[model samples]
Target: MNRDIAIMVDLQKLWDRKVEFEDGISHHEKSIAFWEKKISDIRKDVSVLKENLTQAELEIRLKEKKVYELEEKLGKLQKRRDVIKTEKELAALENEIKAVETEKDEIETVVIEEMESAAGIKKSIEKKENELAEAEPKMHEDIAYLRSKIENYAKEVRELISQFNAGLSKLSPEIKSRFEKTIKSKEGKAIAPLEGETCGVCHTSIPVHIVLEASSGIKAMNCTNCGRFIYKKENV
Candidate 1:
């Protein structure tokens, strides 16, 4: 291939490498983001579990306090029962005692249920804590590795860009200008190969003479339809 076309091809290769590095960086960044979100979600779950446990404990305490009050009332009523002289008074005392005992039983049942719920909550909290403990380190390691990969990709991108610029500088000003314009217009691809009589990029048919010229590698040409610089694959 002509020197200018060869330079353009090399420049395109450099551009591809730079894009590859940038893509790698992007992929790693996305992975880091995903892990960050997962960590945040886990932490939120742990917080909610802790809140639930606290609420359950509070309810248990309140129910136990009610039970204590009922028991105290029942004790006082039983002590007073012996002093009652009338059958009616004794019957009233017994009914009062019975009522107090019943209330106490109900409250005790509630407290027991609440205690059971609290125990379950504690177990769940422990499980979640363990999960967080295990996941946190792995998440950190993953993020660190991804960041390191992105840093390396950044360096590779810089090197590729430097190489592309150096290769571009070696071309004639006219060729450089044309290459730049063509790259911009052709979505970063300034050059393509001819296959048979077809432009590789635009798939347009090339005239016999232009195909012959491009195949000869004596000169660099553009696809008549797409205007991308064209060369023969064998020549490139």
Candidate 2:
């Protein structure tokens, strides 16, 4: 019932609520982190697909160039027929042309296959990008909501801290120091009401004199067993 103990009890209740809000903030932060990881994974997949498309495009270009060179070689070989001086020479030139044509056909086939593959890769990339574009906004919206919740919790904690400081400043230096020590030792709880003759924290019996001093409403006292500041409540 002492003024100093009353102030500390109020601060302790506010601190208790702050702890709960801090827990809420942590929960929201974890959810945001989860969404952020998903976004990162999606972008990573897109990047890998793009790299694959690049490689496929490069290979297709090389195959097409090879086909072109083979065509040129076949055309030159055909022109050699005009200058052939023997049937043997004609046969040799025909064989050379056939070989060049065969090689060109094989390369062209590969080029077509690679072009299809590249097209498929491009389609995959587009689909993933589209998915990201659509889903990213929703993800961001969810994150924003989570952040807003955290902001609200943080704001409450800040206000509680401000009010708690104001209340704490009203106490004498000795009481303030004792409250800080007990709050730290007990993790933000510095006072407990007497439960009959029992210590509310440790459930130990209160000594006759300590209980008398605390219940007098003149001074606050500590539990002999658990070292927590003890108080007696007046009827509301």
Candidate 3:
């Protein structure tokens, strides 16, 4: 085969391999992104937990203050019991004090329930924080590892591209330009090996004259149907 045609074959193979290597790089990039998103979500969840804890604490403080106020009110009502001058007045004072006591008891119950809720929330926060402390570092390590793999794949692609460009450099400018254009138009495939008297890719019958020239390796020709360069390899 002509040296230029041989180089084209080699360049074609290089281009295909380059695509595969780039795909590897792409895979790693996607994995890195996934890890990053997962970490972000975890942090967001932790932040939301913190906000809820703050709100719960504030609520508990408010309820406790209400209970204190009710107790003070009950104490003053009890002191009024000592000053009662009649049986009817004494009975009315006792009923009023009982109402105050009931209200205070209900408020205290809510305060205890809220304190329990706050405790549970605190425990959840602690658990999640511990998980984050451990998982965040591991996630970062995984992302770093994936990034390194991408770097390696990128380096390999760069080298393969250099080799492919070297093969193109060996061709005449016209042939090189033609190959570049065709490869782009054909999605990275610009040449096909001849299949007997037909185009290997499109299977279009080659004119006898064109086939003879191609088989002789005297010149290069394109298949009219598929528009790819046709080359014949020697029988090995």
Candidate 4:
């Protein structure tokens, strides 16, 4: 099998670059979406408040209609009192008028309270809508900026891949294939440099005989601990 340290290094570098670009793009998109969701929530709140105000206004109108009906009935009762022939009939009519007036007074109080509530709700709705309107433009700008950054990052990642491929082509075909297999299995990390007779990739001591074999470069060697191909660097 081909075991080329240079090819492995390039592949590892490319993998790191790809991961960095992917993570950056993901973070940027998430931030953009988060802001948009906040804006949407604000808009929804405004709509709910508007609906509440409308309902309150409708309730007040109904109450006012009831008050008008009460006034008309009270007027008719008063007229009857002037022309009534029986004392018992007049007393009943007066009692009815008093009861109607009391009910109307209670309803009017409720109507006033509802009017105030409706005004407050309308104000709240307007405030939230204005906030959302101001925020929407900022959100759009943020999303556009993120998209631009992602585009640039993708270009960088592509350039890195091209460089990595060029580095691999310099290796012997057999070595290239072997390194590709090992690196793929180990997640783009292969051909680790030996440190003080220890496998740097696996952090395990290499046998004296194996260390000598790696130095000679007659055959490929791997770390017994992690099974990654080993390369010996000349200097520290």
Candidate 5:
């Protein structure tokens, strides 16, 4: 019974180490994912800013063309006014010139606004690009360090599994099955030490006879309340 208890204890200890290492690896993986997401989002934002600048430049060109066409029409009307035969024709030509000039003025205003917007967009793109450049190296370094830690954890877990398997081989089939079931139900704790008259894990009082039997270490004893195998810590 004592040998079985020893086997279970050693197995549990090894399993606990495996869990610890695996949890560490999981934590580092999450950190790496977070950094990757940040980099991707920054790149996407930079792309959007660049697209906005391109669109603004195209709009500016179209507005400039409209202004040039309106100005050309105004110039032709002004030249026609010199040959006008009546006051009405002269007035009509004046109206046409004024209309064209007004339209050109509005288009020029839009062009100026678009140019300013393009400048702002360009500046924002530059700032975002710089930020991405600075962050990429640091993020990559951190990811590499995290990956190294995961690799080390994986190596240690493999070693622990080998030790656990060696310990497992010493246990009887009946005891091994019982231990597996207990660990599954009890969150990896298949055995609990006796604490005074109670089970250390569940803090439930044990029968006097059962506590005495467990203390003798004559056989492995189960706690009545929690069904965990009981061991005497001092005897061990």
Candidate 6:
């Protein structure tokens, strides 16, 4: 294990932390989107309720008009009751009047039922409206907070990346390129650390001959078990 490799592993750790912060920011954005979509869906539901109420009212009005026309026909038929008409004709008119009255009654019942249903729909719409009114501002606030967090996290990542790159520039090009390649290939993981006398990334034990060479920190060493470079850490 070499000191330069250790430093590369430390840089990878910083990169990992940077990714974690970025992921947190992404999570906040997704949360904001979820709430926003919920609010939108609720509003659509409220709009549908309103349309339902309007249609229900229209149906009630149509039924009421039918009842009114039936009553007018019944009155006309009753007026002809006293007219000198044939017995059969008067009977027919009476029957017609009765039928109209029955239909009018049925229409009135339907109108009443429709009106009740409309009232229920109106109540639902009102409740939904209140819910939307309360939710809209809160959703907006949540989105704003999420956006702010994302922006702050982005700024912090930029600063960290600048510092990381500045540190990387101090190393040789070959070592830096190798570290970058390994970091990318390992998904931001450290290439090496001591894991119970073996390389954490490579799972290889250090031979006594190479152990001193690695511990001396003169050059980077590759693990025999896995090809990942090994680095020595003083604290560990």
TM-score, per-candidate, Cα-based: 0.81, 0.70, 0.79, 0.78, 0.87, 0.84
Candidate 5 residue-wise lDDT, 1-236, digit = tens:
57888777778888888889989999999999999999999999999998898899999999898888888888888889888999998888888888888889988988998999899999999999999999999999999999999999999999988898788778888788788777766377888888998998899999999999998887888999988888888743
Candidate 4 per-residue C-alpha lDDT over 1-236 given as tens digits, one digit per residue, 9 for 90 to 100 = 23465456556767677767878988888998899889989988988898888889889999999999999998888888889989899888888989999999999999989988998998898899889889989888988998899899888878877777787788778677776676667356767778878987778998989888876655767777777777676544
Residue lDDT tens for model 6, 33-150? 8998899898899999989988998898888888888888888888888884698998788788888988988888888888889999999988988998998998888899889999
Question: Per TM-score, what order, best first?
Answer: 5, 6, 1, 3, 4, 2
Candidate 3, residue 168: the lDDT equals 87
On lDDT, the candidate that comes out on top is 5
Model 4 regions more than 4 Å off: 1-3, 165-236
RMSD of each: 3.0, 4.4, 3.5, 3.6, 2.5, 2.9
lDDT of 1: 0.85
Candidate 3 C-alpha lDDT tens digits along 44-156: 88798889889988988888888889889888989998898999999999999899889888988888888888888788888878888888889888988888888888999
Q: Native-vs-model 5 lDDT?
A: 0.88
- Residues 13-58, model 1: lDDT tens digits: 8887787788899999999999999888888888998999888888
| Better lDDT candidate (1, 5) | 5
On TM-score, the leading prediction is 5
Candidate 3 residue pairs in backbone clash = none
The alpha-carbon lDDT assigned to residue 16 of candidate 6 equals 81
lDDT of 6 at 209: 59
Let me know the TM-score candidate 2 reaches against the reference structure.
0.70
Candidate 2 error regions (>4 Å): 1-3, 86-95, 181-236
Arranged by lDDT with the best first, the candidates are 5, 2, 1, 3, 4, 6
